[model samples]
Target: MTSVDLHLEEQSMVVEEDEFREGEVPKRKNKKKRSHADLGEDAEKRGICYLSRIPPHMNPSHIRQILSRFGDIHRIYLVPEDPNIQVHREQASGFRGKEFSEGWVEFSKRSVAKRVANLLNGEQIGGKKRSSFYYDIWNIKYLRKFKWDDLTSEIANKNRIREQKLNMEISAAKRERDFYLSKVEQSRALNFMQERRKKKQKTVGAESDGTEEPKVIRQFPQNRPVADGGAQTKTKLSKDILAGVFGGGS
Candidate 1:
C-alpha cells in the first residue's frame, strides 16, 4: 500500500472530522413518536383502583413484593395521608380503626387489578395476629371504567329520581290538604245558609201569627130581678147562639 505523509500545524485551523460539505444531504435521525392509542393504553394499563381497609403498616414496597408474584405493579399508593382525617395520621404510627384504610394501586393491566383482587381477597395482611385486609373478597372492588363522570352521573340520576318522587308525594299531600280545606269551607257555608233560612222562616211565622184574625168577645145577658130574689142569679146564652158556637148540637 502507498502511504502519503500528512503535515500537522500547532495552533492552526484544521478541517474537523465528520464536517459536512456545503449542499451535502444531512443524516436522518430516527425519533420514535407514540400514538394517542398507545398513550391511552399505557394509561389504562397503569390504572389504579382505590383500596380500603388496607393495613397501614403494610407499605407500598411490601405490598408490591407480594402482588408482583401475580402481575407487574406500576405503583402503590398508601392513599396520601389526609391532614383533615385524624385516622390516617394515627394509622401511620401502627394503630388501625374499623373504618377504611384506603390506598391506590396501579398495575400493568386492568386484568392485574382484577387478578390481585381475586388472589388477595381473603388473604391476611397485617396486625399482631394478621387479619384479612378486606372484610369480604367481593368488597375488594374497583371503580368501573376509570371514569368518575360515570359514577357521578349515576349518583346524580338517582338523586333526581328520588327528588321527583318526593315532589310527587308532596304534591299529592298538598292536593289532599286543599281538598279537606275546601270541604270544610263548603260545610261552613252550607251551615250558614241553613241558619239564615231558619231565621227567615221563624220571622215569617211570627209575622203570620201576628196577622191572624182576632178572637171575638161576647157580652152575657143581665140576670132577671126575679131570679135575684131566689138567692142566686144565672146568666144564660141563647140556645141557637150556643148551638152555632158548639158545633151545631153534635
Candidate 2:
C-alpha cells in the first residue's frame, strides 16, 4: 500500500460566453460526446513509462505532483521488485521499501509520455533547478512496446524458478555430505573390529607357543639316627649322599 493518490488527469474547464444573444439568456456550454471507437483510441494512446532507482520514500502523490506537471497522467503504478516481501504492518516502511528497484508511470497521452521519457532519461530526478521533486533521485526510461503486466509476470516467474533451483542444489549437497560421513563412520567401525580380532589372535598364539620350559621339583631323603657301632648307619640328606646313591644327580 504505497501512499496512493487518485489524481484525475482530465479536469473540467468551464468557459463562459462574453456576448449575449438578443432576448436569450446564456446557457450552459455543451460538451462534445465521444464515440466508442474514439474512446478506444484514447485508451491506446495511454503510454507507460518506467522509472528506475526510485527512492523508497517517493510515493504516488510525490511522483504525480512532479511528473503531472509534464503531462496528464491516467495512473501510476509503483512496482515493488519483491512482491512476496511485506514490510512490517506496525512500521511506516511499507511505502518506503528501498528494495523496490523500479516502477511504471502511465500517462494519459502517448506523446506526452514519450516526451517525458526523452526529456528525463539520464538526468537525475532532482538535478535540475526549480524542479518540484528537488530531493528525489531516479532515472526514467520509456519501455517502447512492453506492457506492465507482461514484464512483471516474467520477472516474478524467473525469481521463483531461480529460488527453487538454489534450494534443490542445497538439498543435494546436504545429502551427499551425509552419505560420505556415513561411509567414513562405517569404515572406522570396521577397522576397529578388525584390530580387536587381530589382537585376540595374537594373544592366543603367544599363549600356545612353547618358548617357556616346564618347572621341575626336587626331593631329598630323610636322615635316620644311628647307635655308634651296630644299630643303624645314618644316611645324609645332601648333594654328595644323593650323588653316591644315584651315581650322579643333576
| Candidate lDDT values, in order | 0.57, 0.66
Please count the clashing residue pairs in each candidate, in the order shown.
1, 0
Per-residue lDDT value at 59 in model 2: 53
Quick one: best TM-score, which candidate?
Answer: 2
Candidate 1 lDDT over residue span 14-69, tens digit each: 21111133332443535889899986768766645567756534444445555667
Candidate 2 clash pair list: none
Model 1, residue pairs in steric clash: 53-101
How much is 13 displaced in model 2, in angstroms? 30
In candidate 2, which residue ranges exceed 4 Å CA deviation? 1-43, 55-65, 71-97, 127-137, 187-250
Model 2 TM-score, 2 decimals: 0.45
Which segments of model 1 are wrong by more than 4 Å?
Answer: 1-112, 119-138, 143-146, 198-250
